[model samples]
Target: NLSVVVIDEAHHYVGSLGASFQGLLWRLERLARHYHARPVIIAASGTIANPREHLQTLTNQAFVVVDDSGASQSERTILFWDCTRDPKTPPSTQAAYLTRHLIRMRRSVVVFSNTRAQAEYVAMAGSDRSHRILPYRSGYSAEMRRRVEHELRSGSIRGVSATSALELGVDIGSLDTVVLNGYPGSISSLWQRLGRAGRTDLDALGIVMVGGDPISRSLLANAAELLERTPEHAIAASDDTDILTRHLLLAAAELPLEETSIEDGPGATAALSDLVNRDLLIKDGTTYRSTKQRPHLGTPFMEREASYEIHFQGTRDHRAVERISIRQALREAHKGAVFLHFGTPFRVQRVDSERREIVCIPETEGHHTQPALFRSLSQGRILEHLEPHPTLGIERIEALVVEQVTGYKEFDQQGRQVAKRKVTSPIISSPAEAVVLTCVDPIYLGIDPEDLFAGLHALEHALAKVLPLLTNGGTSDLASLTLRNGDAPSIVIYYLTKSHPSTMITKVIHNLHEALSLAEHLIAACSCASGCPFCVLDARCDDEVIDKGAALALSRLLGKISVGTALDSSGDEEG
Candidate 1:
């Protein structure tokens, strides 16, 4: 019956966050509701452009305004050094530089890297610092991570580099600073990590190192917009039947979860029992359990260890528990070294692959080595223009593109190794499915020849914000591609999810006709046989952009479209 909840990374579990953000969320909500608990959440996510309506719908409750706190310190001080001229400003180098810089100023620091390998690299480089550098993340044996935390608390560590595991409130000790190596990719992430700083008796210092991307540029530009803007808010999820169904089976593993019991959310207990009527659950006595197969917690990503165990000279203690990953292990121990464990400067002589241990000895030299791969970011150039060629199509004139990615590839898709692509991005413009509504003029800002690419980048930023809403309901894939005519250009979104385009075909057709009806009043050129930007669209459009004005008219014409989904069916879907 816990009414209060704190949902960290709420955005990650939405219907359309990842390939299956919705599926995971449905499971979470189903579990909560089954126990007669509804969370009034203090939810967290990256920057939220819209908070009020988002949270109200997300949590399924009438939510009132709470403290919309500004970022604890300066709006957000982002520094972009010109690294293209010198590739030495790699994540690892910059991480070490930030730590040393802070330590020089007598401040404690945390380095947030995008991956575990990078975190370990940074930690290894700073091994000799008196405030020992600690590598923290989810993958290390619970024993190892706990030991790391203990050293941090004792001020035996100067810096702790980590993955997202440290992003939450796992306070090892208060630090004077935090250095974000890359954009954490969301508003909630930025603020939550920033919260790690300013925790000391002294005012904390915060620094964010930017990766080269349009999103990163936008964040750097509007560093203070949130100062006058509302605080980032959260969005919750509705119940999902798939999750409920899964829980129905798992509930049997604990105690019989009977239909008509008072444990389910709202009217869920009775609703769940309908499955028994359908023979999904078998009723015995007053309780009902799954008629299906057994529940599998499955194997964890790595060797599962005690969540909070630390061994010190054969003695052990416990700390926070979390999932371990390959990324976390590499990030924490890549440049494995031995520092003073109990008075002696330990040496990590070599890493044993099979044992997952770094062979170490007392340090023979003054310095330990953590190799860094330098990548450049501060290649911030102004946008020139867009030129179209029939062969290459539309190309960006000037933009900040990833020139050469020099790290080990972690995830590979379509044969391109992830995080290793020498990605090049132009001030790109693509088309999105539009609604024909002219009620509000779409906001357009002038692009200086130099800033044209930046404008395109800002749109890229805006599109990311808008696209998440459409695909987030959970059952789908979200992607986009570029669409350009001989003269015009736009983006074509391929949103494949639970949303079926076939279902709304009729209303879409009617709205298109309404758009055609308005072409005469809107413009005569729209009716011309020759190609013109303004016109009514049919099904097979090269650039599938629906006019917003025409769309709103159609929306008013269609009224509210309700999708009734039963969350009590938790049976998982087959591919």
Candidate 2:
């Protein structure tokens, strides 16, 4: 019999992970009811702003939060290293140099990167004869991860570059220094990563290398405000249709689900009916049973589309290197792309869609590949609309997004474009949820038509980078598209996931006014005479259309609109 359930690192209970865990808790409660036993849940979180509320949302039960710590405290020093001050060297290069310096000081250090590719790049760049820094991320093989863990514990490796995968409560011995390559999405995450060092009573040092993103740059300018700001709230929609559907299937397989056992929400009822219609569930005497054996086997905790297996082509036999999601495979493991694993480069030879496998050969060349993508969005139904200001209108819509990988560009070891080749790949199209921003008239900004479009493009780029900081989501979680509807220009900020309801987008809509204000500050704070990667320009943007002055003008015009004001009450001319 279960009496107490302890959830460690409870802040991770957000997004799909939180939804899956919530479903498990629901089942556990049902089982306990059958046995007439009640279990007390104790959730422990370090850096959540609303710990009690977050846990309640996760488990559907009330919690009494104990915020104070009883353990001994360690003296820690957090130093902010602004990368904008030193623009001559790249941020990654500076990170590698700092990692090497920290290792030379005989202090064990962990350098945290925002992405897996950046981790690998830092590890490869920081490796020297005296010490070899390795990359640790989610896509690596379990065996390789275990080996790295063992090495780190035994002090065999003094330094490592990793993504947020290492920020959790993993036992990887004690660390002396923590280097943040960039601001990790939110304040809670930033503090969580900094807490990785000095687990014991030993004094620790944390270095944050601010990147060129709008959020990071803003934090750099207002360091005091950032330090004093409260952490963002964590959110998870347990009643989301796609998430609920998967969990309901798993619950039915665990024990026959009755009307009394499940919540009678519209989404739940529709999911149940859809399952029965698809022959995945059988209805018998007011109960539903899964037709398939162990339905949980097919459902993963994390929501993802199809996946592709990467295999190393050895002389004698092929060996599985790692498995990657289909989206990542399209961008990184496309045909003729150079894939890096454990600091070793592999050139992809073939991407077999039928077999769902990517075969690669070890490459001795020093080059990288980046895919060129084209994205388009079709008309969608508006679910809600709000006009915060007379000139600005925001709408939540459901639409279909089509993404195509047109070709790839090859870059040499010196970060110079060496060649560009076209490749034939399947188009990816799926349903998405988006928040569209429309202006009453583009003429209000008094900018040329060409520059108006360019400013809109720049604003979209800046918003995509800045919204992640406010939404508690990553840059990959949201995407932006600019559209011109006659004289009015609209920017569509949509989720990257397919057919899923995300609280992140909801937060974006609620905080759209704040986001615009931040964007305006970011554009004005930038020292560049025109647009640059540090402000409005995106490094990933292949198009060369961007205008900083025009974007600033448009942003100022939009920011003037009062939030929460009704469109009818504004008494302004509409487009």
Candidate 3:
């Protein structure tokens, strides 16, 4: 019988975190029932905003969340380091400079980078110091990582640079400073990384070095939300049909399920019946057992691995395993593409989609590879519509996006494109739910048809950059699409999660007035003149389709649109 189970870094149990934990938890729950020993589950995370709700959904059990550790919080200072002051220098360079300064000041610091390459770069840049400053990342051996941790604790290592691999509580001792090379994407991770410093009532300092990305620039401009707003809530959709079936089958294999079995929850009855129909299970009286003594059942709860094993030439020992999703593999693992593994470069030789692996060899030629993708909206349907004004309407839509990685470009260290190649691949489809806004009569607002498309497209791009403020998702979790519906210009923003729609994002969309107001504020607050990446132009948008003046006008118009009539209509309809 299981007495206790502890899940650490619990926030990662959802989304991209694959199914091993689900299988383990299912077995433990059954064991507790059979042995009459109820094991206590202690799920731990330092950053989740809604622990109680997230735990209930993850484990299908209620929990009494204990957020109070009784440890008083230490005073902390957060600084936004705007790299725009010196546009010629990269954020990594600035971070390296800041790290060196902190080391000189005798402050124990940990610098966090979003990628392994940046981590190594920072560590290398700061190696000039006399004290021990080292690079720590997942690629390092366990013993090596342990040595670094030990050195840091023993006061031998003065500073360390690392990726998110060190974000969890790894007992590195208290730090005096944290330098973020880029926005950690989510506020949860931002705070968690900062928590590494200032432990045990010691005052600490946190610095965010603005990267080239638009999201980082936006956050740097409006720094208040990063510090004052509540961190995004972590939500899980554990009612996945495939996951449930796998757990039920495992339970049936473990013990015969009877009518009164605890395994027979609300949906378990239907699942078992389906299995019996499929001949995977047999019914004897009221009990169910596996039809095949050794059923070829696979673990379905964990994420499937469609990854490439990068091994050193002439050696069977694998250097690293780059676990990528099917969609990411298609885009990132094409032949001739350059892939960076733990800050080291490798060029793809072949991609065997059937084997679910990419074959790559080391490349001494230093350059970064970026995939050029083409996307089209396959189909769309309006599920609901709220006309906020005579010319403005908000629509809830279900859409399918078809995308393909057609080619890739290589950029040298000087940021100049040097090579380009095209590849043939099957299209990838993503079905999503979207919130679309339509402007029926743009000319009525003194905007031309061409200007309307450009303006709305620009608005769509800008809104997506800031959507993470409303949900537990990052910029990658959502996308924006702009298109023309007959004569009207329309823009759609949608979530990418397949399990369940993010209610937080949808709620913000439902209140279009507030969303538009916030979107306009972001565009207006940008320091760039006549629209730059910081304001209107998104990396996804076509330069031909983005106009800063028109976008600002469109944002202003959207903000002024009166939803009073729609509110009254909705109220009367409810009545």
Q: TM-score per candidate, in order?
A: 0.49, 0.77, 0.68
lDDT of 3 by residue, 1-575 (tens): 56788988877665323233555576678768788998888888778788777777667688998877565578899999988787776677678778888988999999999876567656765667385568787646677788889889888877999988898758565688999988776678889898888876678999988865655656766788567756666644343344556666767777886756645465567777788999888889988887665453554445443444444342245655545566666666677777655445677787776676777787777666778888766546555656767788776666676888899888664345788988886677776777778889898888997788888888877776555544434355567788777688688777554544444335446456766777788788866655554567664454446776788788889889764432222222210
Ranking by TM-score: 2, 3, 1
Candidate 3, which segments miss by more than 4 Å at Cα? 15-27, 60-62, 70-73, 100-107, 115-161, 200-202, 211-214, 259-269, 284-286, 292-297, 312-338, 347-371, 375-575
TM-score of 1: 0.49
lDDT of 2: 0.77
Give the candidate number with the greatest TM-score: 2
Candidate 2 lDDT over 436-551, as tens digits, reads 88776566556676677778888888787678567755455678888877677788998755535655567788777788888999899876666655578664565667788888
Lowest lDDT block of 10, candidate 2: 566-575
lDDT of 2 at 79: 88
**Candidate 3 whole-model C-alpha lDDT, 0 to 1:** 0.70
Instruction: Give the higher-lDDT candidate: 1 or 2.
Output: 2
RMSD of 3: 7.6
lDDT of each: 0.42, 0.77, 0.70
Model 1 segments more than 4 A misplaced = 1-88, 129-131, 211-222, 226-233, 236-241, 248-279, 282-289, 292-464, 473-575
